[model samples]
Target: MPLILFNKPFQVMCQFSPHPSRPTLADHIDVPGVYPAGRLDADSEGLVLLTDDGRLQHDISHPLKKLAKTYLAQVEGTVTESALARLRAPLDLGDFTTLPCQAVRIEAPAWLWPRTPPIRQRADIPAGWLALTLTEGKNRQVRRMTAAVGLPTLRLVRIAIGPYALASHPLLPGEWQEVSPLEMR
Candidate 1:
């Protein structure tokens, strides 16, 4: 099995195909036959795994598997206790209700790299950092969750999926490293 851990850069598309107007995984990844196990929105940045193994892809991306994904968010306001409480509860996002998850305020992670074309800065509105762990991946779920509670997400980055941490492998944006099935386990 071919396992790849890639640090997806901001503005990069998740798929391996060439897009008409946007950069795709093919722009950075060259290993044929491997596909991204899951997707990250072009506006979001994070760790992404690619694999040629179909079963491993299913295990990693399937929501039913309930693999925990850790995220570090820069939200556009002081993250209030009420906001944290709301995030920890089963909040509804119109389409569906979310399961309870761990949410907490955290200092900026030292390992975080500066985003190119950086998130807009505000002279007045304060921003805060938060660490969130969710068992399922939803479409822009973190952004919607924070927005619902009056805190808009400025930037979002997935630091890990399950036990595979981006920090543990030390990959920079658009960089990829190969790993073993045993190591992934």
Candidate 2:
């Protein structure tokens, strides 16, 4: 079984199928027969895992497995301790409640590459960075969570999934590399 780690770019759709306007994973990865183990939203960027093995995909994505996914979110306005506290607690997001996970204010990572077209900037409102780790994923969960606490996300990036991390294996946007599945264990 082949597992691939791809550095997905912002605004790139997470599917292999063609889109009417935006680029898809097919536009970046040419390796056939492989599908994303989990998904990253088109507006979001960074580490996405793809694999050809069904069982491996299931193991990586299944919520029951509790594989930690870490994201770097640049949100509008300064992050307060109150907001961080709310994020650290189990958050009620209407449809489902998010499990309590690690949420912390962090300095902007030095290794982060600038997003193309860049995130919108305002002269008055300052932006803050957060490192959030979640065991479960929901559609637009991070964005919604931040909004619930009065901070809207400007840029979102998934830097790690389970044992694999972009910090250890850095790849520029639209880049990818094949890796052994055993490393995931």
Candidate 3:
């Protein structure tokens, strides 16, 4: 069983399961035997894991494994240092408090691909970066967390899964590649 790293693009579903009305992981990934290790919402993008080994999938996606996932979120609003600090501190998500994590602002780069249906452009509104890390992958957690902090996420990209980064692997949108065994740890 080999591991695979994919740079999932926006509007792509994360599973091989078919959706008659929506595009799924199947539409992009043709590799047989490998299944997604974890899921990214169809609206979100980047750094998805696929593997043939069921155990490996469990290790990567299981909550017990606590594999830290890192995301570079482009959020709407003028971000302040206070907002960054708030993200690092514990967040009460109604059901439970999120674990303490890391977050900060970053410069926007031109390398990002233009979304097919671009986020509504508001000339008066601004956008900023937030590097968020979490051990738990809740349903739309990152987007929800940003919204809770008054910064709605316009674009989300999973920069890394454990030690592998989408940048290093570099899969453009629908592309995917099998990771060498040495890199799967």
Q: Number of clashing residue pairs in every model?
A: 0, 0, 0
Models 1 onward score TM values of 0.97, 0.98, 0.94
Which has the higher TM-score value, candidate number 1 or candidate number 2? 2
| Error in Å for residue 120 of model 1 | 0.8
lDDT of 1: 0.91
Clashing pairs in 1: none
The segments of candidate 2 whose C-alpha lies over 4 angstroms from its true place after superposition are none
Worst 10-residue lDDT window for candidate 1 reads 176-185
Q: Any runs in candidate 1 off by more than 4 Å, and if so which?
A: 183-185
Report the C-alpha lDDT of model 3 over 34-150, residue by residue, as the tens digit.
Answer: 988889998898889898888788889998888899998989998898888878888887887777888878888567777778877789999888888898888888888888899
Residues 31-143 of candidate 1: C-alpha lDDT, one tens digit per residue: 98999988888988989999999999998999999999988989999889999999999999999999999999999888789999888999899999999999988899988
**Can you give the lDDT of residue 25 in candidate 2?**
96
Q: Show the lowest summed lDDT stretch of 10 residues, model 3.
A: 176-185
Clash pairs, model 2 backbone: none
Q: Model 3 lDDT vs. the true structure?
A: 0.85
Quantify all predictions' global Cα lDDT against the true fold. 0.91, 0.95, 0.85
lDDT of 1 at 113: 93
